[model samples]
Target: MREIRQIPSGSSLPDTQWQPPYYDAAPPPDPSQEDTWDVVRKIWRRKWLVMGITFGFIVAGAGTAMVMTPRYSAEVRVLIGLPDPNVANIEAVLRTILPNSETTQSEAYVISSREVARKVAYRLALDKSPEFNPALQPKEGWWHAVSPSRLLKELVALIAPKRNDSAAVPTADSAPMTEEQRLEEHIEAALLNRIEVTPLNRSHVLGISAESQEPVTAARIANTFADVYIEQQLMRKQRATDRANAWLQTRIGELQQTAHESDRAVEQYRRENGLYETKSDTVIAQQMGTLNADLVAAENAKADAQVRLAQATPRLNNPGDVDSLPSVLQSPLIATLRGQQAELERQAAELSSTYTSKHPKVRDIRAQIKDNTSKIKEEIERIVRGLRHEAKMADDRYTRITARMEQLKRQMGQSNDMTVKLRELEREAQANRTMLQTLMQRSKETVDQREIQTSNAEIISYATVPRNPSFPPVTLILVMATLVGAGTGILLALLLENLDRTFRTAEEVEEYTGLPSLALVPIVRGRSKAPGHVVKKPYSTFTGSLRMLNARLSLANENSAAPGGVMMFTSALPGEGKTRISSSFAQLMATEGQRVILLDLDWKRPNLHRMFNQPPGAGLADLLNGDITPEQAVYHDPASGAHVMFAGNVGRFPGYVAWIERLRMLLYTLSRHYDLIVLDTSPALLAPEVLHLARLVDRTVLVVKWASTPRRAVSSEIRNLYSVGGRIAGVVLSQVNPRRYRKYGYDDAGYLNPRHLVHTAG
Candidate 1:
């Protein structure tokens, strides 16, 4: 081992000269605080994408609203009181049995029925209107049968083979309709669909609303629908009445003829057997009663004649009792003679005293008494002869009556059979009359009802012209579009962030690689052309960050395995700003008046010589080949006053173990000449010697490009170095964009912004 040459004080020393440096086991890795700013950063990074998506959605919404057809709506309210006009119900009387939810719905259904639609369509000529008739106009909306998307789907379905080999079952009646009837039906259905009938509050009232392209047409459709339904109901009632009248008239005629025939049969049967009726009795029984009464009257006449004959005999025999005899009392002349005889007798007796009756003379009274006696006798004889003749006539009449009565009794028995047949015929006539009467009454009542027939439902409110269209709410569409766009954009941003598996923050590097982040080296434009800018622009944030890195590396010597002067830069991959970082680091140290040298040991692709105005030849490779000493191979940058060694003539010599001794001698000689040695090694994963070189360095600074280096690669390489006894001082984040890095949720990243940094030359 060579003796230490100008090594800075307070630098870490190797435990042994022959052995590799002892890794300090980096002070427990940073906790890597997590906060809300990380999420904000991801969103901010994609804010443009979010806005673009949201704006696109808004435009689409506006376009859709413009393309949609406008519709006007009108409603006609109707009250459905009862189910049927022909029947009386509690609803019609008390009006308390209101229509239930189901009944109300049924009424609404009827109002919106296909039949009603047909009537309204006919009235409004909906088939001719383009709004309801597709045949009259081109179909609306984006999708039609011949549209590109639909054609594509049909093409695919036609070309694509079935997954199964079985043949498809043919659908029944799958024939396509290509007729005017189909178009007419389509128009009818379209008209029906435009109208909505809803029950209002579970009552009998229905709201028949219709939508159309024109407000007047919508109102007309609703009003006409209600009017047609009511008209149809009235027509039904009238037809029902007419049918009833016709049936009743036909039935009444048939019944009247049947009654006449039955009455004729009863009369014929009665006449055949002499069964005549008076009140409730037959004619044979009446004739029998009349014959019996005539016989009694004849006997009474005979008795009266016998009595008068006896009285006349008594009166003729005794003239003094002649006045008491019936014949004498009945004969006016005889009575007068008796009275004269009595007066004559009294005159004769009273002649001596006073002349009273017939006072002509006593002699004349005696003569008149004698004449009266003779006249009384003659009257009694006349009475006896008339009595005898009357008696004889009475006896003959009585005999004739008795004989007729006996004949009537015989006829009555025969008439009893006729009475039975007659009664049967009479009952049939009565039944026909009863049915005729009933039908006649019903027919009369129906005629009366027809005059006052009314509809079951009436229109309570007629539709009026609508003021506005009822579709394509533009404001609502826009708001929804905005929400959808924002949500999709946020999701897209999150997806991109997750897909980006690079380390974006110092916290990420520390947490992933288990190493302290020494510094965040901001990216410098055209750094390749001016690699010495760390010293060239000493006040720039780029140069300031390099100083910070240098300071941190120096301070880390306390916990590192090797001296602070021998610092090497590497990364998980090439082009991670390691070379630029190492060169700038060396220049910054040189500007501080310390002896600093940067060596490009990236055997595959070294870029350090570009930092200085020098040719690329005979540098690290020459040193590794033992062809030149370290002092001879070092290239100097005149602008930054620093020394740099580029990868020279890297012709791919022996790989891993070959350069160990030469590399050590070169570092050993360089250590004596320079106060700081900055080694830019190849990507850690790409070269096996990078790990070997890491073992020999005082401190290895793992350089990870910000938002560029993969976390897995960085962590794996850091673990590999620790496993192989290599000293990793810490990780350095290179090429950071302060504007973007600010969102990375770091406290110190704010100062890295260009706004806070200097850019003037030194």
Candidate 2:
């Protein structure tokens, strides 16, 4: 058994003028109270809904995959070979300059080109083939009825202009295309869409693939595309070679004429100018060379003569200095005179030593020396004159040579101009001749190579018929559909959950109502055998919740200044189990040895009498109308051990406004006898009497049905009660499903275990 604390009596009543904390509006939800686990719990609760939607999508995807037609694909591999060596070298040079990847990509683009598709379509006649043309095939099922393509085609046909023979018609020749052009576009589109071209990694190999409903058609299209590509390559090479040959032939002729004209012009110019070619050893060249040598030699001779004149003229001024001159020394007359002078000087020296200064022998020797010296001086003068004469003759000879050389240089200058003109003409003719020979050789080579030109690509492997389809992989489709559907379903579930305005947990009630949840009453599935089931099943969860609620109400009553006061039970809407909660709370309080009274204050539709199995006779309505006394109206139930005042015959009573004073008197009278007064009032939203009763009561507890009543409705009713100065103690969440509450981890796992239940002796 659980212990119950005795609430103190003689407490003063709470102020009737008290207003609700959230009188204007409902309180905002606290963000800290809402955690990630709350969201996870919400999603977990709707897991089945999400899983069902995902499975449905997966099934639909599988069905779609099964309905789709299987398409077969065939491939052909071809090598984009290097340019031919025998043909024009320009193609080979271009290939070398381009990167390998670029060339391979170019080849792939050509393979998938619309032009190539047209060629294949023309060869295969695919426009008329039923396999390729969708319109030509027979309609199989209603699947075509919903096709967007078919619908668009039908709409186009309806709006299209009709052709009439009587209408003014344009001439057929004015159009560039023939009647076949109408079907050509359709065939090209179909072929292009069916073909796939890809290049191998870093290699000049292209893979051309074609897809179709029929394997044989796919294989044939692939192979035919390969053949067409090869033929196109060969044709392009041949055309290039032909163009090269034609251009070379035409250019060679022009070059030949140019060379001939140039040669003729050179010869004519040479003949008219009277210019002749000359070697380095020619006569004029040799003359110029000789002139240069002679000029150098004459200048050398002049310099020598000048030097000799300078030496010889200085010596002629002194007779004694004549002995130093080689010319005078070599002369025989001068040498004989020199010897006589020396011998005379020697005889005079000996005589002067033996006799007086005036002696006759000394005098005769001195006279002889003077005569020899005069003769030597005369010979030296003669030699000096001969040297001057020789120098003059050499100078005159050099001057004559210089005059002749200057005359030869003037003649050589005239000859050199003619030689330059001859050399220019010769070079022009030689160049023309060489160019003509080269052009002639290139022309011959181009002509010979034109017939043997080859393509730069070749087919390596032909396509074979494919055994399997490439599209509509059922497993992959199902997997992807499942993933997408699961994501969408989870998102939708979360959105719906957020849109729901109901309260699911105690935290929500507290956060939104701005009041503590006094109790969380687990849902009782069926009606009990008696209204006093709380006392009968004392250890049950319902009874336990009721006991807890009784304790909270007692505490509220203790807190108020007035003890033994009324605690009204009401909800935002009807059918929220407020009556049951009130009855159970009264019974639990009575079992705890308290004087409790359960009042059926719902005048419009009262149910307290039904719960107690009593007749609707002489209850609150009779007492309020002064037809009965308080003792006569109050009936005690033995099972619940509490007094019940039923709302008897409300149709016979006066209106609620007229009976307000009497109702207040009746409540005050009951408060005097009972320790706790529980009022089961009508829903606040449905009855105005609930507000009146709430104003008269000491404490008002709003009963909120869990996961069923909207928070807006509860808050609105709460705001109404508060508007009229009603004292709301707190809220109580009724009818909480225990299993769901446990799933949310709200209930302590071992707290309510069977071991905790005390078994009384029978």
Candidate 3:
């Protein structure tokens, strides 16, 4: 047979042919899923918490609605149309005068400016509102404006236009401001607030409407805007008419004076010079006419020469005509030069294909082409310069002949006619001056009429008193309140659920410690009659949970490798039901016909002696110090026939290492006779007792107190136990409160009711 080696706890198990028995319950799932579900289910089960949170939000929203202040709005419309027809179009006119949607919307924004709002504010005497009046309470008035409650309402009203139904201004003389006076400035703000000026789509008409706290004020503001704009238009038109009339008068006088002065000058000059005949300066006129004729003839000749030159020249370097240069270039030397050029061209082509124009071969080819081109250009220029000289000579000859011909003609016929011709030319000049004066007068009058026409944008319809109020959307408010309330409520519930670290259910205990929770012990409100009485068996509710714990250990028996069914109860901290749990587990096992031995392993606090009604100084400590034998230290538990061992004298006990080794050997000796051994160990965080006793036990069970242990300390305790050589049997939930558990969907009655368990104690 192969020797089986026992593996120490916390260290990796030795590789041996061993198999743990499969459990009926499913294997522990990934903790993330379990933790997440625990949190979610806790929140879902606690529906009252979420409902309470939602109600709070709903109440807040209702309060907000009641506290909000009311606002007013108004609007007025202006129509854009063609200027009075009497006016003429200006040079920059783009389209026919028609109302454009884009322009209307832009102008509406301009009308809603702060300057406009201030004007309206002043007119309406809104510097002191009923809610904002300083005389009512100056301190409170300022506070209200700055308050978040007040700010929200005003901001909403300003940005989102809505109708309002506020009472009209009082008409009595003692009223804050007269109805007319009060509404004036308010109308301005109202105009800015609820005013909507929409141009009919694809049409020239505009529709304007205003909503306000006071319906009459809305109407008045709207009508006033229309009237003011119309009046402004009229003033502009009148100014234009005045300017036109003045300009026309000035231009008429200036034109008449110019005509008279020009006529007088011409007549006077003609009479003094004795000029008459055909017209003014006939000699100079004839010379200019002859020069113009010669210029035309020269230009025609130049055109013909340019055409001949174009025909004579051929394009060099034409790809299509390689042989076009001439057969004379076929000499051996020329052929040699051409071959060299072609070779360079081939090299250049290849280089150009792969590299930039700056490459060496490309640059070399370009330089060669440039030199050949320069030589060819020089030859072409020489030929063209000769042709140009011939054309210039021909033009010079034509100019000299035309000038002489004009001089001869003037000398032959116009000698005595000079004075008469000068007089006639002066008369013609006077007539032209008079015609120019008449045209200028007419142009000035037309300009004056145009100026008058440039000044009109029509006010087509006026605003009327509004009859409806526009806000306090109840439906909208309620809907928002519902959504905010529900979401915030759920969030609050989840927060509380996550923050609570109490162990209310078996799932929670297993989730934090990575161990199965075997049983839940309910809290007892009344006393059990005797002082420090040990109810080890299921004779009372306090001891019943132990029976369930015994079943769990039995299940673990088929799984762990250790032969002895040694049990140890430990916790993260003191007062976590470790001693009580150990006592009950031993008693329950003993009642099941198994011989049980209960050891008080926690020398620092020997509590088992108190539970068994035995003096603490007569047990394990005395036996270890050679003061008594095991037979003298052991006491029989009357409740379940389980034997109990008390700590003899804590002060005289051996060190934890020596005592634990001795205890383990003792447990092995007693295991041959007893079916179960239970050790009640101290908190590992406070002392090393639990760690020492861990080696003596076959399995360990952690006791978790309800709502008492800190979650971080619990996690650390689990990690500590795993670090040592110990096997975990399961967890036990002690002192559970039924009412509190019910909120998390845990049914306390299902676990506590007596009818569920079948007993065979008979």
Candidate 4:
């Protein structure tokens, strides 16, 4: 005898502690709660696809860089110094004569100017050089090789008729440009595009560069441009100096002529005025000078005479007081007489003191004093007469000189008018002479400085042939292409994922259908001879998935009053593996020591008998037609340990409504004996019979194909089943890829081992 282990109707484990291992049937995840890892896992699963796209772009970019024409750049450095002070001085005199206003900046502009470009092109004959002329150079790039322009040109050339080579005629009406003009224009345009000028920061240096297909040509063009610029500067300086010199010479000549005329005018005025020179004295001037001296002497003599006359007149009243008169005091005779009289008076005074008023000594002294006084008076009269005569003579002389001085003033006034005209002429002549001298000095200095004038720019370095091309760097292009390709691939992957409307995980089925998921069944690669995979491969992942599904179903049954219930398996569409799942599930329940029966209620397309390798026989249809009892129709599948009943020629039964009622009766009878009865019905979406069967069953399990079934289709079918009052236990995702299943956060490998279950022998 063998003992069988059976799972209780009521599970001891809590729902939170132990859920079905195949699927997490918890409430649908919050829509707002985003899963970043889920998106990352999707991208990671498709990483190889992205890497392949990136590599393709890299290869394409590398090929493009390889076939591109090589271009080289050559640079020539120039040192621009401050404007020469000499040149600046010349510019002051002749404004706009020099082009060295701003040292480095102006030079850079000049180097990039069209005139300089034309000059450089002409010097190098760039119009004839293929390097400068795009029309002259051969087309040599991958784009050019593949271009339609090349093909068109070739085709046109082939189609056009050829003209006679030797007898070409020239048209006189055509105004074609001369070779010189053509070359000039071509050179100008070529140099303009090829040349670049940049000023160095905070320095008087400029970089003039040229780019070309050939290394040597680029170097030659740069150096030639610098040389041509210097030559142009020298030519401009020479032109300016020549012009200044010519102007100075003309001005100097004019000044010399004016100075000569001024000198002649001065001489003519001197001769006309009877003046030897401006400084020579005139006759009136000489007479006035002599008269002025005589007048001064006469005035002095008059003053002296007046003083003598005044003294003499006052002394006339006292003739004996001759000594008071200026003339009398000067005479020696008068002085002697006064002395004798004074001595006599002294002796008489001594006698009178001793004698009476009439004493003989006193009377004799008085008579001597009278005689001396009379002699002094006579001398004073003589001196007064001499003084009067001398004063009158001085007055007459003063009067004569005054009359003569007045006459000379009239004559000198006439000479003054002539002197003013003479002075004006001399001033004009002197001014002209000074101006001429200044002009001559300036002209000489300008001539001396002309040869030393030079531009404020020089070439500090010359361009050399470049060794490497500057365009189409292969490594950089490839790296950029790789990054772009990777980004594009990732975006494409996400876009496709959003457009896909299939269920990828068990959570997706539960969320869309609003039902808990019973299990996640992996795709079985090889088809089994027996449809019951849970019995044939008990240790496989498929068997484990079935076991988990049975456990979930058992728990549901335990919660209900009907422990042994009719559980029907159906899908949204045909070929969702519902039939196989139903058969496998019943076998799984039987293996756990439960009395389970598998029924094929899909009369429209019955396939249960084929799954069990049983031939066509009496099944549920035969019982409803009263041809056989339910016990006679039921067949035991020893391999799965479950009884199977087929549809058994359901076409013979014409009344489907009555058959549906009989089917319900059949299920009720089976439920009395079996712990679980699984009915494999037609897809709810395709067959109308599925809805009837759904109402008869205790529970309805919706089977969905993983990553293949459309979400809308599954959802619609579930709704239809529910509309009929069907008891929807949960959903089951079938045919899931195990490798991809693990990525959904479920441990698919953990359920593959069946070692946890011990099989007892009967």
Tens digits of per-residue lDDT for model 1 on 1-762? 111112243343333334333333233232254357766777888898889998998887787666666678899998876544544221221122246777678767666776777778888787788777776787556565545434644775699653331112224656655676566566666777678888877467889888887899989998998898888766766776688788888999999899888888878877776676889687778778887888899888878877776666655566577557665578888767777878778878878467654566766767777887877777767766777777778778878887888888778776777677777888998998899888887777667666667777789999999998765567887899899988888889868887877878876666555567788888887643465676556677787777667666666555433334677788889889888788777777777777778888887786777666567888878777777876788777776677888888888565556777667767777777777788888998998888778666777888889888877777778777766666677888899887778766467775575555553221
Off by over 4 Å in 4: 1-42, 82-109, 129-191, 199-205, 233-455, 506-514, 526-532, 555-564, 573-575, 600-638, 646-660, 682-693, 714-724, 742-762
lDDT of 4 at 741: 64
Backbone clash count for every predicted candidate, in the order shown: 1, 6, 28, 0
lDDT of 4 by residue, 687-730 (tens): 98888776676667889888888777886776676566566788
Would you list the clashing residue pairs of candidate 4?
A: none
Name the lDDT value of residue 453 in candidate 4. 66
Return the top candidate by TM-score. 2
Candidate 2, residues 108-225: lDDT per residue as tens digits? Answer: 8787777778889889878778866766889767866755444644675689643232112446666665546646765776677678889877677889989988888899899999
RMSD of each candidate relative to the true structure: 13.2, 10.8, 29.7, 10.7
Highest-lDDT candidate: 2
Worst lDDT run of 10 residues, candidate 4, spans 12-21
Taking all chains together, the TM-score of candidate 2 against the true structure is 0.72
The alpha-carbon deviation from the true structure for residue 562 of candidate 1, after best TM-score superposition, in angstroms, is 12
Global Cα lDDT for candidate 1: 0.73
lDDT of 3 at 375: 49
Off by over 4 Å in 2: 1-39, 75-97, 140-143, 147-179, 199-209, 278-432, 443-464, 473-476, 526-540, 554-565, 588-595, 610-618, 628-639, 655-658, 742-762
TM-score of every candidate relative to the true structure: 0.63, 0.72, 0.55, 0.66
In terms of TM-score, how similar is model 1 to the real structure?
Answer: 0.63
